[model samples]
Target: MLNVDGKVVVLTGASSGIGEATAKVLANNGAKVVLAARREERLRDLKSNIDKQGGTAVFKVTDVTSHEEVDELASFANDTFGQIDVLINNAGIMPLSFLHEKKIAEWDQMIDVNMKGVLYGIGAVLPYMRIRKQGHIINVSSVTGHIVNKSWAVYSGTKFAVRAITEALRQEEAKNNIRTTIISPGAVVTELANIITNKEIKKGIEESMKISLPAEAIAHSILYAISQPDNTAVNEIIVRPTNQEI
Candidate 1:
């Protein structure tokens, strides 16, 4: 490991699933974790647990869809921790529905939460990282980002945009000493599937969940990426359960 001890890490979507898992993993490894999410109660609970484990942590209630709130989150982390070593743009939503279903509202929600949210997080942290000339940005994508499936068009589009954005960021910030990583996971057991409004799609996802990897699996991958030496940037990691074919 590259000694992440005392490193300041700011993680979005810290209330549940992969975000919650990553917070615990990083905090236990000695990182000062700043947790951000819309749910204040959940964030507080998570922070308390981390403290109980002798890991340092703090929480900020934030809605990633709002650029202002996201900016405040970054500022909060910096003000509280003194510096931010990493920013994890892990907040997202998955509401799969066929295009013909005309779930325009759901489509908009996904775009806002999944695509725009990632962009806002980057915008919030890039300036601070650029000034420091040392930081890492991790964005969560999905296997659907690589290959679209039925009723997953909009969801996949958002993830694909995430991949594109992360790669471009990696290229642009490399000389500035800012590392970028994209984590693409396949069917991890999380609350993401609950957002699917389409009956058929929800059923399909439930069936897939039976063999899904736990959120901790993705958290381990994140730890691995951030643990690398400054000169080595793990650009992309695609993780899935052994039983998963996609």
Candidate 2:
């Protein structure tokens, strides 16, 4: 919590799962957290909960698919906190199926939210962070980003893209005092499985999730990454359940 305290963090997909858990953890440690997602009611409720725990938190209803909304999210955080110390591009979706099944809408949704969303977040905060010469960008990837499963082709592709993007940002911005972190979590308990329409794939995922880690597990990894000294960039973390094989 050393480097994490008193930082202003803008987190997306903050309504549930990893994002929500991370927001609570960071705020509890004295980070002024801006929770962003499309669900206003959820954001409001989360903000209230954080407030109850004596954590600094704010809510912004945002759709990661829209560039304008992400920019506004950044500005809102800046106007409120006076400085943006971190951006967590944690918004994403995983709708898995065979390529032949042609879940075009789901595929498009993944690319829009998983890939473009991360890009927009980077763009939103770069100018300000560069000016201050200090910031951190933590991107939530997946274990699938490092390995492709039978039905996880497209989802894996997007996650892989996240790793690539984070690496590029690190190479380009480390000189400007911008730290980049890629968090690749494996089979965390989340609602991500609810969106998988393929019956076969869903069943398999559910079985595998019997050994899943809690969302808080991933959040702790984030805490470790951000709590590192400012000169140390915790570049990538791949967290899988101890029993997880693939």
RMSD of each: 0.8, 0.6
lDDT of 1: 0.93
- Compared with the true structure, what per-residue lDDT tens digits does model 2 show for residues 40-118? 9999999999999999999889999999999999999999989999999999998899999999999999999999999
- Give the runs in model 1 whose Cα sits over 4 Å from its true position: none
Backbone clash count for every predicted candidate, in the order shown: 0, 0
User: Which digits, one per residue and each the tens of the lDDT, describe model 1 over residues 52-133?
Assistant: 9999999999999999999999999999988889999999999889899999999998999899999999999999999999
TM-score of 1: 0.98
